[model samples]
Structures are given as C-alpha cells and as structure tokens.
Target chain A: MDVTLLSTGIANVASVSAALARLGVRAAPSVDPETCRTADAVVLPGVGSFAAGMAALNRHGLGTALKARIEEGRPTLAICLGLQLLSESSDESAGTPGLGVLPVQTVRLDGAPRLPHFGWNRIESAATEGLVQGGSAYFAHTYCLRPSGRLEEAGWRVATSVEGAPFVAAVERGAVVAAQFHPELSSTYGRDLITRWLERARAQSAVDTTQGATPCR
Target chain B: MSMTRIIPCLDVRDGRVVKGIKFQGLRDAGDPVERAAAYESQGADELCLLDVSATPEGRGSALETVAKVRAVLGIPLTVGGGVRTLQDAERLLCAGADKVAVNTAALARPGLLTEIRDQLGAQCTIVAIDAARTAADPSRFEVVVRGGRDRTGKDAIEWAKEAVEAGAGEILATSWDRDGTGEGYDLALLEALSQAAPVPIIASGGAKTPEHMAAALRAGASAVLAASIFHDAETTVAAVKSDLVRLGFDMRLVSAPMLPSVSENSPLPS
Candidate 1:
C-alpha cells in the first residue's frame, strides 16, 4: 500500500519512511497539500518546535488538507511534535495554534524534571489492540498533549500527568493513530507495529472490496 | 515509576573498544559491537559509545561504528564523541542509533541542544557533561568540556539545569574527580544536580561496585554508567544488575527478549 508521510521540513524523515519500507509498504515524503489528498494513508512525521512545525505545514498549505483528510475518515498518524501539533495550542511558544484535530493543549514540562524526556517508558495499553503494543516504548519530548475527554481511551497514553497535568502520549481515533514516540528508532518490535497497522489497513480494504464499500485508507 | 537502568560505557578508539587509565595508556578490551552485544546479553539496560579520538577522521569512524552497532543491537543505543550538529544526530538516527549524546558542542553552543532536540526529538538527544570536583569547594563540581581537556567555570549543578532547560533529554555526567579512581560517585554533585534539574540523570565516573550503583540511584540518578569496571572485566553488567536487584533496587532483569545478542556464527573480533 502507498503511505504518504508528511514532511514538514523536519530532518531525518528517512527513518520512518524506511520502517514503512520494511513492512512492504511504500512510504513517500509529502511536503505538498495535494499529495495528502491522494495517498492511501497519511503519516505526519516531524521533530522540532511546535511553532516551526506548524509554520511549515501552514506554509505548504498541508495543515488544512490534513484536517479534511481526518474528517474524511482517512487514517492519519502523527509522531513526536507532530502529535503535539494536533492539539488546539501549545505552551512551547505563546499563541501557537495547533491542527485542532484533538481537543487538547500542549504544555512544556521544563520544570517537572527536564525538558525533553529521553528514554524508554512503559505505556499501559488502554485498548488491547491499536498502534501501540501493550509495553514500554521509547519517548523523547518535553511538551505533551493533554486531551480533554475519552479521546485517549482508545490507546495507552504513556505517562499521564508528569508533575501535575495529564499529558497525552498516544492517541487513536478509529482509523487515525498518533504517537509521541519514534517507532522507527524503537527496534524490531517497533518496526512490527508499522507492519501491523499496514496489515490492518490492508485487511480493512479487503473487507471494503468484498462489501463494495469505500476503504478508509 | 520508571525502571532503573544499567548502561555499559564502550570507549572506542580507532574503531575498537579500548580501556584506559586516567584517559591515558589505552588497552584493547574487545570489539565495540561484540562488547556491546555481550553487555546487552548480560542485562545492560542501554549502551553508550564514547569516541576518544579528537580528530575529524575519528568522528567519521565513530559514526560508521555507530551504524554497525545499531544494525546489530535491538535495544537503544546512545552515541557520543564529536557529535556537533542536527545533521550529525540525524545521520546517526537514520543509521539506527536511538540517541546521540553531546558534550563539548553543548557547552560551546547551548542552543545546539534545542536545535538537535527540535530536529531529531528530545528523547534521542543526550547531553553528556564531563565534570570534576573543585578543590576550592568539594560540594561543587565544574563542567569540563572538549573530552575533559578544558574546564568550564560553569558549576556542574548550574550546567545541568541549563542543559535540561536548553532541551537536553538526559544528562550523562562524568566526574573527573572520581573518574578511574573507583572512589565512588560525587554524591554531592549528583544530589545537587538531581535536585536542581527535572529529568533523569545518568551517573558516570568513579563507580567501582554494585553498592555504588544503589547509592547513585538513591541519590536520584535514574541510571548508572560505569566504564572501567565493565571494560576491565572486574565486573559484568549482569552481575551489577543482579546485585542491584538483590539490594531491592527496581532494576530490570533484562530477559533475552529485551536485550540484543550477537549470533554464534558471526565473526568475533580478537
């Protein structure tokens, strides 16, 4: 299946793209809004400041395109700062507007213990099946998303409430999946996750084909 | 709660694992990848590779070696020594390195931390602080830069806070005062930095026993990094973790599923 990964001017996108490649999935980097509309699935892979990431998406006019795709039931995945940018706003920079995909806000945990939490941490799975396996995944971030409601009930959000606030580590909404960790760098198990998602997408397409229904991909 | 970590430091010189005394008179311990795989098999929580050479050519070699290590190891790997930019970190990550540790570059340009972390994500960036206890004040240690070649007047505590604030995800603090001495960690420095900073700290330098590991953890270090003891064959990573587990520390047992091991048929470096 064709997987178009959103590249918002962030470096080292090949890591994620390569993981998808290993899964028998073709991963392409998309910096254009038009590309998001045609892909079977879209993955927003980014690392950096929320403000800068948003700026790149806005500059490329892919920000609006992403929301439209999500609304259309197309599977979308966000990673690291990409997940944080899905919120309404972020404390990383004042007045920075997120994609508003999830009803949440991003706050910097600079005072909690450090800025970027760099290491492997456990994520107790909220749902037995989804993008996140019921185990510890690697995470590296200072700011995290705090979703308002049961949106995170579909996935195990790693480490809720660092010091005082509920931080969202992973999120899943039907076909949409997002994570705060870099699964590409997460080793063999991590690579397996991408494969599972692709298989799920493929299986869903087969069912749609049999039923003469439109595939979500 | 986070699981306590046991990291084996692999000091590399000329593309092979080497051990030295006081940063001089080096001895070939084993191939870095072989040594790393052994430690991983023995329950090393993670692995750290520090390039000892101070040349541009050596830096390139370190990156290549990192790629080789990442290709074989399934667990996380942190690479240091001459990491100077976001591009360097990017290359290492693409090569399969889980994290990149920076020392002198961070001190020279504090903003590099944010740049690398922002570009590659913070969890993949580790700020390695080389420090030494100050004679004037035993309570404080000074941050040393350039592979412990120059001393920065920056206090260890202050630098730790700054590194964390600047977007460093973790700190691999090496105390020159206690390095290679097996005297135990500079607890005062560890406590001060741990209390002042908000992220996990990896205690390096002066660790000679399993007891030192427990003491550092009690002092708030989430992980303990020891080079000499492991490299010199005085102790094994498994032995240390077992000791820590026996001491009631929350150390991971490192099942074979969690760690990486080299195949028996693979070429073993002499």
Candidate 2:
C-alpha cells in the first residue's frame, strides 16, 4: 500500500514510517498537499502545540488539502496533535482555528492528576465497525476533546478513554481515522490496528475509484 | 488515570548498554539496539537511552545508538545524558528520539527548557533531576548536576515545579541517597516531588523488587524507572508489570501474539 507520512514539521515521522515498514509497507514522507491528497493512504502525525501544528499545516496549504481529502472520503489517519488540528479551535491555542473538518474543539485535560496525559492509555470503542478497538496506545498531550455527543451526531464514531475525565480517544467515519494517541508507539496493538486500517484503506480507495462519488457530500 | 509506565533505562556509553553502580564502574550489558528489542518484548512501556559517556567523542556514538534502537523498537523512546543546550535536545529529537531528558543543562539555564518546549513542544522536554538529600537538613533535598558530581544547592522539589512551569512536561526524579542501593525507591522524596510537581513524576533509583516499583507508584509516581534490575536481567519488564497487575494495579499486560520476536529482526506479524 502506498502511504504518505504527512509531515507537520514537528512530529517524529520516523516512528510512523518505521511502524509501516515493519508491516512491510514503506511510507513516503511528504509535505506536499498534492501527495497528501492523492496518496493511497495518508497518516497525519504530530506531537506539539495545536497552534504551531495548525500554523505549519496552513503554511504548506496542507490544511485545506486535508479537509478536501477527508471530504472526498480519501483514506486519512490523523494522530495526536494532528487529531486536535481537525477541530474548530483549541484551548491550547486559543483563537487559532483548526482545519474544521470535524465539528469539535480541543480543551485541556482537566480533572486528571497530570497535564500531558503521557504514556500508554486504554481506548474503549463502542462502534464495532470502527478501526478503534479496546487496546492501549501511547499518548502525549496537554489538551484533548472530551467525548462530545455532537461529534457522534455529526456522523463520526468516537471512542472514549479516561485520563482525568472521559475524553475522545479515537474518531472515525468511512476511511478517515483520527486518534489522540500514537498508534506507532502502541506496539502490537498499534501494528495490528495499522495493518487493519491499511487493509480497509486499500479496499475503500478501490471502491471509491469505481463509484466515482464524492464523500461527506 | 494515566497508565502506569514501566520504563527500562539504558545507560549507553560509546553505543553500548552499560551497567554501573551509582553512575560509576561502567560495564557493558549489550548493544543498545539489542537491549531495546529485549525490553520491547518484555512489554516496557517506554525506553530511556541515557548517554553516560563522559567524553565528547563518546557522546557522538550515543546518537548513533539511538538511531539504531529507533530502527527496531516501536515503544516511546526518551533519550538523555549531557543535553547542554537546546541544540543538544534538538539534535537528539531530530535523531529519532520521541523525548529529550535534560538535567545539568536545564539547571544551568532554565531557559533551555522553555526553548525546547517552544520549539519541540513541552511533551518533548523532560527534566531529569538528580537529587541528593542535604546533610544539614535531612528533610530537604538538594539538586545534583553534572552527572551527580556537582551540587547545585537548589531545592529539588521547587525545581521540579519551576521546570514544569518553564515547559518541562515530565520530571524524572532520581534520589542520590538511594541510587544503586536496592533498598527500594526513596518514598519520602517521591511523595514530596509528586505532590510538588504539576507534571508526571518518574521515580528512579534504588528499585530492587517488583514491590519497590509498586511502592513508588503508590507513593505518587506516575511511572517508574529502573536500570540495574532490568539491565542485569534480575527481572524483566514483563515480570514487573505482571507483579504490578497481581498487586491489583491495572496493566497493559504482555502484548498480543504478534510482538516481533527479539531473537531476530522480523517484520510485523500479519
């Protein structure tokens, strides 16, 4: 499978690229909006401030390209800061607008004993069909989106996890998957999840090719 | 609650894992890459690669070691040992490290933490505070730096809070009084710092048994770091995690059936 490691100019793409390589699928790193849009699968990975992440993406015009790609139901996987960047705004970067592909906003992880919510945490998925499953994944973030029913009502499958309070861990609709955790650092569960996602991304891309239909209307 | 982390620390000198007593008498354990793979198979939540090399030339190979380990391991990798400037931390992060632990450098100039945080993010910056109990005041802890050779005269607990405010996301607090003692972690130190520090506290030094780890966690450490026990193969990360689970602590558990075999370089199990 052709995978594009969407470079946010901050995250360690080597980890995700290495994870894919372990799965015997080589990933090409790209900051180009065109490659990010047309790749068979694109993994948007970041590990930093929401404002900085959005600024970098917008600088390269990949933010608009990603919204277009996800709107077209093209295979996309966003991780950590990448997931937060899909929201409308964030407490981490107040007044800084995100891509707004999803109707959500990121807020600081309150009520938790710690701030960053670092380390491996368990993800509990209610949707049986979604790529997110009940497994542990690596997380390093200060801000997160609480489980908002509005996201689910917006036609997205949201998985919740508890760090301080229940927060959205993973979200998916069609071939687009977003997680507030780093699957690449999740070991076996992550490898399995990536492999499964790759399989689905391949199939969905194939079906979309034949259907000649746009996604997300 | 955030998951309890079992971190296996590698003190690498000249690209090889080394065993030492209180950071002295270094002896080779194995290749950093090989040791990382073993730790991964043992379910280590994260791997800490510390460059214990004293010479400038020796530090060069430490980055090479991190790159080699990153080639095989999928867990979170935190690299440290002699991060003197923001450039040092940046070099390590650019060399495939997920997190950079700074100690002496952060002490010398607290702004270094802010610089790393601003450029690389707070999650990437960790302050590894080596604290030795002050002899004059038994209740007070003094910060030690330059690989525990110099006394900073700064309060460890206060520094932890300041470091966090300065942009350190985590504190890897080690007790000089208990380092390499194997008597168990310094509970008082752990409790004081855990309560004082706003960020996650990684308890280090003097952990000998699985219960020692549990005791540290109970004392308030979000994660536990050990080198001698895991490096000497006295116990595996899996064993410690199993013990944590048996002690009524929830664990991620020994991974699924597909974790790559440590015996050889293998592709992801499909």
Per-candidate local distance difference test: 0.73, 0.85
TM-score of each: 0.82, 0.94
The per-residue C-alpha lDDT of model 2 at residue B266 equals 26
Q: After superposition, how far is residue B64 of candidate 2 from its true place, in Å?
A: 1.3
Docking quality category of candidate 2 according to DockQ thresholds: medium
lDDT of 1 by residue, A18-79 (tens): 56765667777778886785466788887767888898899999988887877665667777
Query: How does model 2 score by TM-score?
Result: 0.94
Model 2 CA deviation exceeding 4 Å by range:
A207-217, B255-270
A108-191 in candidate 2: lDDT tens per residue? 898888877898888888777778888788889889988887897888898888986899898998888999988888888788
Q: Judging by TM-score against the true structure, name the best candidate.
A: 2
In model 2, state the lDDT of residue A91.
90
TM-score of decoy 1: 0.82
DockQ of 2: 0.68
